[model samples]
Target chain A: MPSIKQIARNEAASSRFVSGHSLCRGCGIPVVVRTVLNSIEAPVVVINATGCLEVATTRYPHTTWQVPWLHIAFENAAAAASGVETAYKALVKRGRLPDEPIVFVVFGGDGGTYDIGLQALSGALERGHRFLYVCYDNEAYMNTGIQRSSATPFAANTTTSPAGKQSFGKLQKRKDLTAIVVAHHIPYAAQASISHWQDLSDKVVAATRLASPSFINVLSTCPLGWGLEPNQTVRFARLATETRYWPLYEVIEGHYRITEQPLDPSLPIRAWLEDQVRFKHLFQHEDAEVLARIQREVDRDWNNLKRRSEADAQWFARHSERLAKEWTGSAARPAPAMTSRTNTNP
Target chain B: MPLKAPKIAPSARMRLLTGAEAAAHAMRQINPDVVSVYPITPQTPIIQTFAKFVADGETDTEIINVESEHSAMSAAVGAAQAGARTMTATASQGLALMIEIVYIAASMRLPIVMAVGNRALSGPINIHCDHADSMLARDSGMVQILTENAQEAYDLMVMAPRLAEHPEVMLPVLVSQDGFTITHSAEPVSLLPDEEVRRFVGDYRIPYPLLAGEVVTQGPFAMPDYYFEIKAQQVRAMRAAAQVFDELSEAYQACSGRRYQAVEGYRLDDADRALILMGSSAGTAKEVVDELRAKGEKVGLAQVRLFRPFPAAALREMLTGVGAVAVLDRALSFGGTAPLFAEVAAGLFGQTVSLSSQVYGLGGRELFPEQIAAVFHDLESTEGLEQPRFIGLRG
Candidate 1:
């Protein structure tokens, strides 16, 4: 129920992820985490994957997390969150727990979500756990020295996929994880960028308020790993979204909705690629083919999303009976606790 | 539906059930808040039957059918930390997948109880009876107890939560039975009233829970400064498990007229030779001991019930009057002696008795009474025990 401005102002007074941890000076992960956490209207239990957020926030006795938090291993954040949600249901149904609902949320990195943890995440969603999973896609294994994950871009340089004389960095294009998540047929799944705080915040609130598994993928910036000046983190994120490289969008039920359109006379894809050191080699080598390929992939993805979002307003209305009949298990469970209406944003 | 008569007289009642069924029955009695499990060979019956219990309104336990054992244990850790009385079951590769989080559950001091059906590890992938699975987690800091029969499986499982939830010992407990050998076979087990069972395991009170409005950080990134201290907390809890188990078992015995000890001694008094083993194989060893005693061979047997927190002093005391001892293990250590053999050697490092080791029952190979008697005879015949022997193995 909180507006974006009100949530930000309230968080400014008392931060859930406190300062003084050793994350990079302008890292976008904290911004994404804080923004997502502020949108929830209930007491939250945060489960974090093993990444910059987990390692830097909690170092032995000192922890920056003011909320109740847990970090167990790298890939089981979703699996662990399923436990919390299931436990909550079992206790509440048995009258051992209070009636108040506590939101279950997970913070996983791109490496954890797109690679090692895909099975667990898929399983939790398929089982219809009532929780929210946010993948802070910094695009590589930044915590373990920037290895190339499936989330890493095709031509981006990483420790594992370094650009050399004979070869370009990361030959394969990044996986369309949002599409893969939508294939699970959960109620809500979205693609947002940390630079678009309002879009990401709205997606988090919508995802957590539902009683089915929900996922949001945010393009979080990593200064140390992405080779950017500490101050240029937000600029890089903004450029990525403006160039249509990372679109601000959401998928509620089966329909896609774009939250922000690119600005008039938007910046070129080169502007998005030129600032970060991960892509500096592309400029130095003047690899026209790689740049064109990257642009082509982005445009194809954006056009696909635009077509889906521009569908008639009655898309769900036409398919509502089938969606209900298709899933009779937890997918179709009655959610009395989620009092708010479903996100039918056009 | 018309029923003619009650199966049992009012004075006493018993029913035939497999090891898995006994475990499921115990779960119903305990009525855990959450149960997360995956289906694997020799362990499928347990979760399947428990799911039926939930469907039939026998218990209000929430049964989560997870994708794999890794998630099964992972979910249990999260639920236990969230202050729910959680339980789970797995075996072999399933158990192997769960070892990482098993250690985490113990470290966090979450008193979750797991029932493991002992099956062999892979390579050839045989799904039968063996102790290889349970031995994989011997040092994971969880309290592991071996059961000798379906009756023992039920009794031990019912008592596990008490030991696990004790204030002094808040580590996880694993109640293991040999796969197929105990899990598939049926035996008569006495039933306890659900009301009595409920009173036995009262409310669970966690010191700090995730959703309890109190700010608590779990599974913290421990640096060098406090890693050892946090680990020592688990160690202290593990060490306190033996006493806690003993007290609870005595209390349970007062309610039901069955007694269980950390290490059960069978005919060990004034014996010249003996055999020591764990799990269902001990039943064969005890039978072999009785047959040897009938022949006046002066033989005895020792069954290890509590393997972790080892009960080293009690185990050593059980073998006091015996001469040569044969330590039996169903799993191999490859480069070293088997786990039980190693623990036994460490327990009696300076003792004067001649010690022998045997590795048997790998991949569910049949163990017989004769093989156990042979071990006792071999211990008596040999001048001094040296090389490790393989029981019932082809030459």
Candidate 2:
């Protein structure tokens, strides 16, 4: 077997994308996309939702992607990808696409995945398309000038949900998308952050190997949208996971497993809050109680995950053989390839 | 000696089918790769029949059940842009909801064909024949075709994809049939043979900008510098559609033994006054025209078929010797004049024809043949009328 370093070097040299495109400097989304595409060896079709990913890469006549990329509307990337995957399966069944196995993937921002595109995503998952969905969670609607989205953090000031004399930024809690995907009882669902590149790459590769729908919610940092220095994208993302403001974990076959644990039990939330203008209002107001309340919520959520991970690990070990048998039986059959000849004229 | 009337071919069978079923049958014949649809009243049967066809294994098309009309059009646009022929159906409030992306579909030139079961606009709640929904989308860069009955509804739909996908006319087509009048009514309509339609329409050829290995841009934001040029190109494309329409109609006539035109005339050859109308009301006017002609009254009717391209030159030539014209529209333009009436007056701008515009039959109220004939009476009584008039309204 080839060493990991050799594989990484080979992928870097043979990348389909070239340097110097219009994407913002240190934008975390392109990094995540490049890493995921580099890991897949099969022929892949990417369906992109209407958001930052689409606007930056496809500026009208110019496109940055060398692969077969489709830019559908804002809310139906999942549905469109479902159609593509269905067509591919029908074609393959008729002995088309015989050259190799093909993979289907969808990419979207939080506004697209957690809010507008949620219905299509839920339907696609329920229909069980053998594909992976990656949500590049940049917190707010970054491409539209940093507006508040359902994924915006609590007490963070955004354009739509500004903190003023009577307001403390966004009062609503961020939606738990990972848990929502797990409720569908899919085969694999994971949450990762840009801070851990190696772990993010490994999870992407593993998710694609599954026979059912798999979801990965990636915490991509937006230097411009988050109001930080352009080069501090990775640093901000690391602080997010380190402070337990965000968590990294996976749910496999109705079981939850925490991939990382916070090292400090009583870390001050102010450290994570002080980096950008979105949280500057809290510091200006000197509202310690509000800050303390948010910290408690984060801590409580993290502890619950730790407990569930332990229970899930125990259950999986106890019934490993039986679960394996059930999985083998329930996994979807390999879809046949689609070809022009199979599309008969009605 | 009169020219021999075209013989009706015996092999061409006619079946009584609703407008919705006719549209569904036409779509089945087109054999689109994907169809994304949502269920709304008046437009639901189109999808229900399509769903049945897919389930019965009668057609091999992928049907996506979307949550809303907005997503349905979005999905169809995406599929069409991805090199697949795609279609959807909606009406009334559903069409109103999809107003935003409908414009986008046309600007992108995706060659999408939609059937709008024309219904009354809201406020007091009505769901019958009216042109409110489709008239609202007049300037959205779509080729708008209005049908008179179930037969025209079916025939227009089969011709829609061909008109929309023409290389010079790469624009979306909106085939509008009166909501309950035609959509729910069953009538005998001759179905076109599938091979004849395929041969007439041919395959969709997207311009070089969108094809594989071609570096071209589509639907980009036209800044002040480029916006004018892009819009100018769209205007030119709309004008080019007239030629495509004529060519296809000629070809369809040769193959199927029936002919259609942008404007249909009824007994207008020797008439001093003509009532202009659109949609199913033309059927009622046709009856009135025949009755009045038998009574030796110098009255006739002219039905406007294509609304978007307006067919200005055709209407001008058709109305050359006419003394006075009365325009009847089923939709209200609020403070302004009626939509079809306004288009007619504008089409005959430089011509020397006296015109009277009237707004009536709004909210799907009953439009009697006598009510339409009253417009002719109003034109005759008031010589050189100064402004447009409204019929069937309380004092």
Candidate 3:
């Protein structure tokens, strides 16, 4: 894992993402974008879906990007990235271009990733394109004025799903996009948050090292949409993870591995929901059931993730013992190659 | 700008090929770096034949089997911006789905080439021939070309990349063949050599490739102040595409014996009456013109090969000697004037040519030579021809 100082030094040497244009003052997206871009060593090309990060960073006649960046539409970032990757492969294969290594990265907001872009994302992953897709999930359609999206949490007050009479804000739970990506059987997929910069950076490094598709659904807090103070962006982000609303874990070659355990596993989910105005209605007496439902859902999901990760550890242990016996039993054969698809996460 | 002539002219070989196979053969010859396509009715055979070429190691193309037409075009845009010679194919509903990215591909100035099997848009779900698909994308900033037969489809596919990649006209080009009529019809097409096509297309290099080390931003969101100027650039590029198409066709004529023009006129020089149309239906009109000329009737046919950039000057020039003209459209504009009729009317605005609009062949309705003869016969006496006429409709 790269330390904060090392990341800062690498970013200083070559700032792939620079500070300019109109991203909000305490936006968590830039940190996620910068860390992911800086963590990868190869030449990187970014394909961005039309959203807050894309619109804000790349206003015409001025751009904050210091690397090759492309934005096609609201729901086709993965498709666009697949194109660029395929082009690179074709050019290199035909000797039209030199065989240089490039990491193609796609950044889409929650609305673009979990909703409209879901089919495109699934297709790209299934095709096994050597790219990294990062969903900077800020929950709702922040760029489109805080409209309700599939990633919006239950009882969240979005413009489309407001907390009015006969309404307890949003009627459903947030979509588990990271798990959806993992179900594609990609080499690596993770649930990361911008609050843990080192874990996010490490996952990016791991994801880019493999020559197959990988994904990371990063929880990036939106200050404007969340109706929280700009300074509380990272605080809210950390609170969510600590409260188990968003857990830090990864799936490597179908094996679940927890990257960070919450400092207080017994922390109530209300601590994370009470401060953000989107969930303000959940605190009201009339919406008490919605808050209880949210807390129960979070606890159930966290426990399920923990059990899966434990099962993965046990499965690896048994597999390793069997491999050891096979290796000892045969003199002419060596241990099998540790390919991404076959290797167990340590 | 003229391309440098090769040392030896390309020798052509005759092959019995359908319009789709001819297009696939052109793609095989050009050997674009990337091809991303989805399967539609008439367009399927084009991609299917190209897939066979790829499977046989006949062409060096990275063909992406995208999930939808939207992704197919989106991928083409990405591949083109990445400095790869890219191509894709689609039809009616597929074109409709891909139109959004098609506009983006043009606005970004990516020289991507697309082959469209012209099919009618569906409410009742018809899968036959019409110009509704390509005409639907008329104002999308792509330079549109319609082919009259398998030979033209093959030839236009070969010539499209050069026109699209011209520095002054870096826009997407749509080479359309009338679905089923041309796409499913087999005809003898003269093909150029593979090496010659490779030399013709040459190498494609964008100033700022996404994979290149240099960083550049593409497809940026422009505010009101910059949006108009950016759109004006697309308009200028599209206007320049008209001259570039002529130059490319001339260059192509040098390699292959076949010559092409934006407006192809058949026996229109000495005629007092003419029929103006586009796509494979022009073939039927041409046959009718020849039969009429055999009887000393002063009737001619003018085919609009290039539909976009309107080619108003060339079209107006084609009708200079003709006193009356019948504009035949294969697609309707619903509650308004037919698309081709509107273009012809706008193109011949200042001229004194009496004009009549004739709509036919919707939902793959067969357009016979006699119906075309009737249209020419209608032009013989240009009286009370104000309302648009629907031909062959049993009302």
Candidate 4:
């Protein structure tokens, strides 16, 4: 993991993502994008879904990206990455391109990852494409305005799920997207936050090293949508992990490891929710029942993660070598056969 | 280790192949860097045959059997932008689903080739021969080529990538074959030598390819100030495709001994009445033209090989001296004039020719010789043809 000083060095040495763009002041997306891009050692080709980062960064005749970047639509970033990765394989195999280490990265928002793009992402993962899919989970569709996405938390007010006499806010709990990615049995999947820069950086590096698909769901802050002061972006992101509302952990080859153990595991989930204006109605109405329900859900989720990590640690200790062998062996075995016809016409 | 080219040259051979299989053979010869596809009826066999080629180690192409046609086209776009030769295939609903990205592929200037097994769009959920699928993507900015038979399907599939990858015309190409009629029906197809085809396509290299050492941004968002200009560049490319298609078809004819043109006229010289259409129905119409000509009716047929650029000039030139013209359309445009008829009307707006529109073969409704002959007979009177006539319908 790179320290803040080292991250600054990396940024200076290779300014892959530049600073001038139209993203809201102090938006957490740039932090996530810059950190993720700077963390990788190899050349990267980024596939972005149409969202705040893509639309804002690369408006025609202007671009903040210094590295190769592609944006197709609001959804299908993973599918696009799958294509780039496959093309690299096909080209290198045929000697049309030099065989060099190139990392394929996908940047998608919560709406693109957890909602419309789910099928494309799932298909790419199942096909076992070597790429890293990073979802900047801002909890709502910030680009199209504060629409309630599947990643939006329970009772969090959004434009689509606005609080009213008939409704409190969004009715459903946020989907456990990291767990869903892990369920695909990919080589690596993790839950990260922009606040924990080192953890997110380490996960990006690790995810890119895998020979198969990997996913990282990073909790990104939206100062405008979440109704926070420009400077409070990192503070709220840290609150998310500290309150155990969004735990920091990773699953590697089915082995779970808790990357960050919150200093105060018993911290109230309200610590994360109370600061955001989206959740202000819950406090104003003195909705004790809703607040308690949120707490219970967080507690249950945190406990489940901790239990899985502990169980996985014991099993992995004995089977680490075998698991590593089986994973890498399956990836390397049966290399696709290459055949070509005679060039009589040439 | 460098791959050594085999000394033995592959020879051209005539083979009885389904249109889908013919497309597969064309793909096999092209041996593109990547092919992404999903299984849709009529279009399925094309990829299925290609999959066997990959499995049998005949080609080293990276085959991605995507979950949906949307992903298939999406992956193809990505691969193309990443500087690989890419292709895909789909049918009606599949084409409908994939059309969004197809538009993007054109706008982004990725030379991805897609094979569309033309089928009717659903409501009654019919899966049969019709132009509804490709017609849905009529304005998508991709080049649309309609094939008359399995032979044309093979020949055009071989030519599509080269046309798409043309430096001046880097747009996606949709080479369509009528569903069931050509895709499933077997016919004698003359395949060019594999090496000849490999040389014809050459290597696909593009400027500012992704992962090409230098970083480049593609598919960027365009604001109002710059969006129209960017679209104008695409318009120029489509215009360039018309001439490029002719140049390529002539080049292909030189080697394959099979000539192709944007619009092919069958005995239109000094004819009084002409029928114009596209796709497999041209075969049926040609036979009707022959039957009518023997009886001294002076009838002719104009088949459109390229539909996207509309081939208006060649079509109008062929129908210039003809007195009466009937435009047959396989797909309906509902409340509007049929798509082909609209184009024909627009093309011949000031021409001194009497025009009529005929709609037929919806959801693979049979288009027989008699029906085509009736369309010719209807052209004689040229009355009550203002409202698009539906042929072979029991009124």
The number of the candidate with the highest lDDT is 4
Worst 10 residues of 1 chain A by lDDT: A331-340
Whose TM-score is higher: candidate 1's or candidate 2's?
A: 1
Query: Model 1 clash pairs?
Result: none
Q: Write the per-residue lDDT of candidate 2 for residues A1-346, one digit (tens) a residue.
A: 1124633774676664446457788899987787677656555667788888787776645667666676657887787676566545433443433434556678899999999989888887887877789999999999999899999988889999998999999999899998999998897898988777655665666577666788999999988878888789888887787788887777778787766665565666677789788988888868887888889988899889878988887776665565444443222322211110110111
Q: Which is superior by lDDT, 1 or 2?
A: 1
lDDT of each: 0.85, 0.76, 0.87, 0.88
Per-residue lDDT of model 1, residues B341-374, tens digit only: 8999999888878889899989999887767767
Q: Write the per-residue lDDT of candidate 3 for residues A172-252, one digit (tens) a residue.
A: 888888888988998689988988887887788767766789899999999999999999999999999899999888887
User: Candidate 3 - CAPRI tier?
Assistant: medium
Give each candidate's interface RMSD in Å. Answer: 0.8, 3.8, 0.6, 0.6
- C-alpha lDDT of residue A17 in model 2: 46
For residue A49, what is the lDDT in candidate 2?
Answer: 88
Per-residue lDDT of candidate 2, residues B138-238 (tens digit): 98888999988887887888888989998888888999888877888887778888777667667655653222333333344435676677778789889
For candidate 4, the per-residue lDDT at B65 reads 85
Comparing candidate 1 with candidate 3, which one achieves the higher DockQ?
3
Q: In model 3 chain B, which range of ten residues has the least summed lDDT?
A: B1-10
Report the lDDT of model 3 for residue B26: 97
Ranking of predictions according to lDDT:
4, 3, 1, 2
What range of 10 consecutive residues in model 4 chain B has the weakest lDDT sum? Answer: B1-10
